[model samples]
Target: MDPGTNVLDLSQLRRSCSSCALSELCLPAGIGNDDLERLDTAVRDKRTLDRGGMLYRDGDPFEALYVVRSGSLKTFVLDDSGDVQILGFHLPGEIIGFDALASNQHVSQAEALERSSICELPYARLQQVTSEVPALHRQLMRVISREVIEEHRHLVMMGRQQAQEQLAIFLKSLADRYQRLQRDSTALTLSMSRYDIANYLGLVVETVSRLFSRLEEMGVLEVNRKSVRICRPDLLAELCRSSGVPASKRRDAG
Candidate 1:
C-alpha cells in the first residue's frame, strides 16, 4: 500500500495484531487469542505519515499510543535556548507516545523520519482492554518499564562516555536492536540526519561527522552517507567496555 494519510481499516488489512510480525515486541505479546482480538479491535485507526510529517506536537492531548508498523520516527523537544533536543528514535515494532502517559499531554514532538505507517491505539479503549486482559496489562507494564530503563541508560551514557565511546555505543546499540527484530545487525540505513544524531548524542554536528570518519578509518564501520555497515561490532563493544560501561547495559546505550 502507498504511504499516505488515509486511515486503514484493520479488518480489511492483511496485517493486524495476530498477523503482525512485530506482535512479540509490541502490546499483542503474551495476549490470548480472544484477548488479542479484543485488543486488536481497540486499535481504531492506522495512519501513514510522509517523511518529516509531524505525528503529534508537544502539548497535544494524550489520546492514543502509536506503534510504528513500518519506517522510523524521532521524538524531540525544544530546549530553553530553542534548540532541538532529540529524545529518541523509534523503529518498526517500537512504540512511541509514552511521553504523554504521565501528564496526559505530550511533552515532545514525534515526526516521521521516513515514510511511515503507524497503528493508533486509543488510550481509553486501551485502558479498558488492558483491564480485562491480565497478560496484556503485564506486557504493557513491561514495555513501560523498559522505556524507563532505556532513558536511564541513555542519561548514563551521555554523562560518562567520551565522544568516540558514545558514538560506538550508539551504533552498537542500534545494531543490537535490529538483531532483536530479526534483521541484519551489521547493516543500517539511518533515517535520522547527522544533525539529529549529534543532538541526541549531546555533540556538535561536526563532532559527529568527524567521529563517523574516525570509525570508518578504524575499520569499525563502513559509512556511506546515511548508510552504515558495522564492520566490527565487537570493536565497538570493546570501546564501550574500555569506557567503563557495563556489558549488560551496552545494548541499550543508544
Candidate 2:
C-alpha cells in the first residue's frame, strides 16, 4: 500500500476488472461493448493512499474523479475553530471527488482511513465520454441523486439525535453499508479513531466512550479496541427509537 509505487496502469486494470464486483457500480450497466471499451481507454491511472494519508486537501485544484477500488476513505471539513467534522465514509466501490464536478475545486478533504486504492478518471475525459454516451450521463445523474439522499440522512442524524441514539444509528448504518458491500456485517471494525467518531457524531470523546460502555452493558454491543460486535441488533434499533427507557435502565439492558 505504498502510495508512491503502487500506482496501477489504467488499461490493464480495466481489462482485468471487466467482471469485477464493482463493474456495475463503477461503469454504467448494460453499456454497449464499444462504449465500455471507450471508457476503459479513457481512464488514466490508479493511485494508492497509505493509511492516514491525505488524498486531497480542501481548496486543492481538482483534477480527476476518483473511484475507490479497495479499503476506505473519510471526507471531512474543518471549522473556523479548526475542529474536524467527518462528512462521510467512502467504502470500496464508492466514488470520491464527484463533488468536484460542479465546483471545479475540492470543497472538502479526503484522507485514507486504511491503505486504499482509487482509480482516477480525468474529468475532461469523463465529460467527453459522457457527452457521447447517454447511458453514462444517466448513471452520473443516479450517482448524484444517491449522494443527495445520503447527505439528507446525515443531516438528520446530526440535527436531531441524542448521543446514544447517534452511536446506535451510526453503528447500524456502518453495518448496513458493509453488508451492501458483501463484507462481514456483524463484526464491525472502525478505521477511524474515537476522536474521529466523536467529531462525526458531534459529541465529545468522553461521551463516545461512555456510550460504548453503555451499549456494552445493555447487551446490544461488545466493543474491544476499535472493533465492535453487534449482539442484539433488533434491541439496539428499538433503543434508538425509544425515549421511554431510563438512561440507567437502558445501560443495564445491554
Estimate, for each residue in 1-254, the C-alpha lDDT of model 2 and write its tens digit.
Answer: 77978776665755443645777677677888778767776675568899998988989888888888888899998889997889999888787886666778998999999999887778888889899899988987887787788888788778755788778778888888889788888899998889888888888999999989988987988999989999988877776676445455767898
CA displacement after TM-score superposition, residue 15 of candidate 1 (Å): 4.6
Clashing pairs in 2: 217-254, 218-253, 218-254, 219-254
Candidate 1 TM-score over all chains jointly:
0.89
Per-candidate TM-scores read 0.89, 0.86
Candidate 1 per-residue lDDT, tens place, 29-59, comes to 4567788778877886679999999999988
Off by over 4 Å in 2: 1-17, 243-254
TM-score, cand. 2: 0.86
**Separate clash counts for every candidate:** 0, 4
Top lDDT hit: 1
Q: List all candidate RMSDs to the true structure.
A: 7.0, 6.2
Each prediction's whole-model lDDT (CA): 0.86, 0.82
Per-residue lDDT value at 59 in model 2: 90
